[model samples]
Target: MIRLPIKFLGLLLFFLLNVGSVSAQYKQTVLNKTQLLLNKENTIPLGRLDALKIAVVTPDAQKYGVFVQQLGRYADISSFGFSKYDEQTKYFNTIIVAGTEGDLSQEMLYMLRQSLINRKNIILCRFQEVGKNIPQWAPLLGGRITELAYPDFSDLAQQNMAMSIFGGLAITEGKAINRTEQIRLQYTRGEGSGLNIAKMTQKIDFIANEAVREKAAPGMVIMAVKNGQVIFEKAYGSHTYEQTVSTKITDIFDLASVSKIMGTTPVIMQLQEKGIIDLDSTMGHYLWQAKESNKANITLRSVLLHEAGFTPYIPFYRYLKPGDVQSKASTSHQTKMADNAYLVNHYYRDVMWPEMLKSAVKPIGNYVYSDISMYVMKEVAEHETATPMDEYVQQILYRPIGMKTAGYNPRTHFDKDRIIPTEHDTSFRKVLLEGYVHDQGAAMAGGVAGHAGLFSTANDLAIYGQLLLNRGEYGGMRYFKSETVDMFTSKQSKTSRRGLGFDRADPDPKKEYPSRLSNSTVFGHTGYTGTCIWIDPKHQLTFIFLSNRVHPQVSVKLYDLNVRSRVLDAIYETINEVK
Candidate 1:
């Protein structure tokens, strides 16, 4: 066994104790700020609002939307303009009134009074005067705002106050603000240790050689994060066999099936917490088509678990042929063929939805790994929330967690060179898939589908995995309750080792993937385009592997080489050796 130096252990303990004290002090400061704003007469403590629903009320929502939206990153928040307030607005536990230049209308004042009478918490920004007499609501706000000479109205002051409201969370300046101190605490508490880099390097080199010999992938990028710290991140070989361009750590890859978990699953979890979605609720509750079809009885839980009786996938794109003309018409899906050549096509969703609704339902209770299930669930989620799936997930989850490189339809926002090419397709569009989704169904759906369309860098994926390891909390933001995370990640069915939207560690020792070193509590998912994210809460470990294994052409040779499984095994072996 590899023994850690005694001095290192002592230092680790000392650092953890100091960090704990510091964290407590920070919490106290935030509490004090809350008390100061809510006044001494307010009996309801600020802690009550921790898990409560919050909304930002503003007279001019568009003007102050960005500020409130920034706060939404650290808290679950909904926004409404002064004119939009209604009976539904009363449901919010905490209503924050962002200052506006105009005076508050009588209707607005009535709503504020009603909220106070309902015992709802209120936070007021002193940027503007709300009414002639400040004494009426001044007691609720602790004090009245008085005009002073030469006030320091700087970005730093705004950020500091926002941080206080969010319980001392540092907002994203230019880069991600990682909770490295918490990671250190988890590490020192025996959750994980620094990786055995030399051993892992040797193993990766051997694996790369094997992959080359077997003609698997020309290159690979692997990153392993343990207890929030990136222990190992490296790139290998060239972009492709034909192209000699060296791969970099920032290169994005087609995530394929990984999109199910990364792009769609977290959104479902968030919606569930907001009481907008229920796992046990039927699909018909959200989708109109499903309500009239035999799928009316299918529950959202079964859909997420892949037991919803949907087929694996349908070649929906096959119905639409590429047009010979290259025009920038808004009606057609324009795809880049070459430097100037393009393929313009349109998806016949009118026919597709009817056909899907009339399709016969298969018997439930068995796990049949289906992509169509996620596609249907995506539509249901979108319809229920009245927000596009891509936009909703990005706003609530990805942006908040600081996943800079994760999103769908990458070509619109990211440069082509940063996005690694996937395959040279001869059968479908007859174009090299660069900055385009490789999945035909998602591509036909305008490159925004639940099953397979997301592209992200290893760094962003690592941040997401770390968020899961932290039990759905990151950067002082609670995205989901710990119980909610556990509910989704825990095994749901006996026949299949499937969590709600995650693939659980196989109980059987003979199962492939999710290395034998992982405990039963571990859950993760893999993508068709050589990407995988495995998180082990038992060990506080997160492993991410990204590669263009299908570059130049799609092949199963990479899986035959078992490169990912071997690398994962090596990682665990190193961890065990250290322990």
Candidate 2:
């Protein structure tokens, strides 16, 4: 075993003795009472737990290293060394971080707040002598944290004593799982601040207007928020062709690609947080089966970000058996392609696996948005979580957030007659697609593949939309975390307009998106079936629009863009601005 350098240990002891007393709040508990040893200045107090050896990171090391050294003892902290000091990855749960007053880096303080997203246990301590101008760590922390600006070391000790008592109380009586009482105590008793909801709303309105003008549909919903509360919420257009069927505050809509934003992405995040999987793990690692050498190194991150370089769309529903085909079939041979039941069934079973045997193109070259990426993700998620995708989402998100209306093939949860139909696929099954998956590939896979299967209304989508706003926390429960949301939503290097499957700002105006949005903070997605959800976190707003654009003909891209634009403009106009 490697030993810690003795000189470093000596320096640490010197600092402990010279740095004056740590707080008496950390009592000198007796370990047989024989270990009591007061420092020369009678300033330091020691305890058995304190005696527990800790690896000291020198001041010369990176700042996060220092912060980790100081804070790690109070909680579990782990780190992966990066090539550069600034790029270090430190794992933190919600452990409050306190530091020498005014002495901490603002960025480091922000990191402390962000650590709370996946990890719920966090604490912040303050140094007696640091000054003001502390970094705004609230957003990362998910709320304003209690600041302990003690007048002296003695006061610091007393304050910690009081905090410890409160912390103990919080642990023992944690006002039921759904109760906000404990949080109220944390706010009132602890010096805490909340997220700026007003600002969140404003940003959303701006983005919604952009998406509305860019990708017009019949109806829309826009919302924005931070820390699990509504920043802004509004709806545009009718829910159905019948004008009387207005969209309710809670009406559910098919999320479409937004479903990935809700389903696969979040599930992957949770798996990472639970230590069950690594983001960088090769697809082969989780699936335990390699598709091909070219695809071997493709990670979950690559697939989620659409960097796996697969084809964009595949016409899977084109398969049919003889007379089962619609006369719309361009050729008798094309009709024959659909009628062979063996070919169609075999295609479903084999599409996702044996990646190496298919096309010779490597997975590393460029970004391509393939529905199959989600399909592969579905397999990885199920294998890792040991549960079906629907059940996994239900257990981890839907049930907790009260998204009772969200699911794949939502025939049981939604009213069949009221649900909007997407297409009349004469090519495959020759049936109207409603109350089931619109994507033929996902339908062939039991309507539960990673892509294009989930059915939710705008209202149900809003719950998830709001959950994203909160950075994975919603209602009274912690879902994922703010940091994970940031990672997934922030633009990746390969695409400016795409963060995983979510939308983002781009310089190219002609690129896909509602044309009105011209900023980076806005993120959203549109469905091939004329459904969309856009959110502006900067403004705390979200706009969801759902339409049966395929009613007469499956105009995959046909819609009156003006109607969506008008609604988007109206929502923006109604935005409430609060200083």
Candidate 3:
């Protein structure tokens, strides 16, 4: 027996006392409600079944470790150790037994055999069965979760088994099987969606494949919903040029500039809805830090409208002095940039913000697309809400919508492989950027910027898009009023095709921006990393295209070849087809 240190045991015992009672109650509640739903015959799925209703058993030493202590942040799960199995075996339809080869007790092995005989969902990983009492079929339940660790273990066998048993289990080829939920859009398929289903999907697939062949991107995930039904949702190709790991529908992509609309704008609108700050008021009234500079006088409306007279972009990375970039954080350099890179502390407040504040404002407002404005707006969000933009959005918006994998600083929540590679930065932080923000300015701000640095899978992001399509309401929860969504998504700028922190189709007759078929009523924003989301209230459509066109290096092939617009046109043509 590997005797755990006494210090570890003390913490473990403390956890069992404080954390065990609640876990036991939670487990029993799940046990009672779940017995009837485990079968594959129920018609009602979300009768408020707790997704967090999970039972976890770790080696005693690891109970207080990162694996268990940190797993619940990303998922709504309730998990505990092995002591309850004998008392609850009759109640459990599934269980995960995780340990090394020598750690499985004969008693645990015996229970495993019994559960296998009971036809339960059994997952055995990183361990080998011992003793003659175990069944031969038990070995077949074995597998490995090598890619997951620490905080990301919420996707462990528990989520997969939960997904399978709780309304998602399937009987295929006479054998019970569990699968990660794909095709997550709830209302989908049928004659009522009004489309030539087969032809529309075939054309969309061809467009995506051609985009890959031309290297517009290595891979892509495309999803489109019309009239509240998912018309198409599919993932194509691999994560990179090497094609080693084929992209899954659940993979998250860096939302680059799209973060302005998806991450920052919603919060601003909600603040307005609560009457915390008037949209029409000058930001100078609220930002005391910028009182002496030109930025203080710009209106919040102009900032969101991208007409705040700021420059298009500033290359802050090019001006880095010695000691500015450090391999590890120190008292003076406390901001982390990437896996090994950290930025000097207060660089934003003392250096970047001062430069932005002093930068000459163009003659009032002629409509310049600037990241500088959103950079200040992030400060405004933090200043007004007294909360970090990342945490504020997560607690107020994402967690409520079940957007499990949507947020800034994705590496903190997911494995690198789970996030698609954005680019290889030859300019600054010279590592291949995976699970890191691709935008240099945002990265310097510790990967949480108003203009960039948000990531999410197509499914989770689509929920946000669907919220706008439904006029600020989704899944029986209302995040914003109908008037609030209307004000933000509608055209709010006079000289440009910009909504409140959103992008719209150009009204000019000479330009074919976004799609030739798109009307002026649709609103969305495109990311620099080959991703976009377009929501159309007129047609009740929400389209999302996520890719990594900058994987090896920066390229505009996604636009040069008109991949997004062409693919979008096909859907419109198919939907309007006469049968």
Candidate 4:
């Protein structure tokens, strides 16, 4: 307006653009003390209370004790009845007084005052109304009390602020208590503010109905997590056409190729961190037989990125003849030949390794997804560590993170009822595959292979997803250095758009696997048995879809159904709509 010089105007424009970018990156909300106390903040830090002990005090200690236990999953938390207020204040660093049912006892009030004097943080929740004057702890709690005609009628005018706590739990709006009881808080701003729970529910419901109507599958389990919190999780349809048993959140599903990432990949990452394996090192470094083969020059990085020239797969199980029925001899090498059992005639390492080494290697520098690459990598990892892949991953990764249901050979640890059936194998095995692995190759590998044969529940997968989002730390323990995580997740090749062991967001928007709304930083993998794990680091989002789409038969293509991608699209659209 003042006819400023052209250079000055350009500088001003650049400054404005930079400001906008910063605002987009860190969207902070202004809220009053009361709002801050009631609402958790967005982008909550991980491992917030790792070093400190917390005690949750409530009048109904038994009732709120359940919430405390859930919070313990992420933090170290203990429950204490009001009677133990004095003792808790003496030991714990922070004390949370929840519920508004009863009047404050003088001893508890005195202890809170002393805690304030000691500069100890105290979180108070007035969830209900009591017939008494406002307690003196109101000022300490960063809020002023105003008498109302009804105790339950919270003033909406004062609810203009929001805060997030416990990593992705958000408290937003003018005191709108939406999904308040749930510990995981979701924010209400920009795209996050407009998340349509109703529409999301409807979408999954429709897909489940269509799947059943079209005989795609009898049941499905969908779990979506944003910022280390589960936003949507549901089980649809019955176990089979018979409608005998209903699917549950606790039920574990066959993960198929997802095993590559969740099982083998993590172990490899750990080995790299321990200086036991190098991505650039040749496969021949670990497998002595590969030292002389064409694969001798192939690097672990190339194999993981799927550019190692290995063929997609080999049906080695087809070569095995029917074992002697009379020889009921079962050892580590073989399973008892039964009607509903896998016929493992010999040790996989002795028989399969030789065959794998003999397999032809195609021309290098091409993007060809190959299960054989993972199979070889599995052998390499096991040989280098002197541990079986399954046992190593269990002890080093799964058990440490409390992923109880995540492991190979589910029949060993879980009950049959807890494991979902994958298929009725009529081709090779000729039996109903329940707790056993569905992949013929993995079944022949004694139910533990790199490309397939891992079972997990939605909740456990969410925990693992959160671990990655946290940059490989969970429950106050550091599993992988942040740099290692970044290295593995970074795009490795422009031509393939693949990470070390993870698949990045498709550059082509038209690709049906990742949602179009997903930014380029999102990385994940989809299993052949209707399982997928997509993580969007930019938005701190993770989505897991586990289903036995091949229950009766493995004919239905999930891509044609657009079930997974559409759900992802819907999630992003809902988040972005408010903006």
Best candidate per lDDT, number? 3
For residues 38-110, what per-residue lDDT tens digits would candidate 3 score against the true structure?
Answer: 2222211222222223344555635334434322322344444567765655555545445544455677767
Highest TM-score scorer:
3
Clashes of 1: 0
* Clash numbers, per candidate: 0, 61, 3, 9
Tens digit of lDDT per residue, candidate 2, span 316-409?
5554345433334343323122122112333455553453225344446376667767877878888877899988887777755545567876
lDDT of 4: 0.68
Q: Locate the minimum summed-lDDT window of 10 residues in model 2.
A: 29-38
- What lDDT tens digits, residue by residue, belong to model 4 across residues 217-319? 7777888876544568888777776779998877889999888889889988998989998888998888899998889989998999999988888888678
Candidate order (lDDT): 3, 4, 1, 2
User: Clashes in model 1: which pairs?
Assistant: none
Each model's lDDT comes to 0.67, 0.50, 0.69, 0.68
The TM-scores, one per candidate, come to 0.67, 0.56, 0.72, 0.71
lDDT of 1 by residue, 162-182 (tens): 443543332222112211122
Alpha-carbon shift of residue 78 in model 1 (angstroms)? 30
Candidate 1: residue 415 Cα off by (Å): 1.2
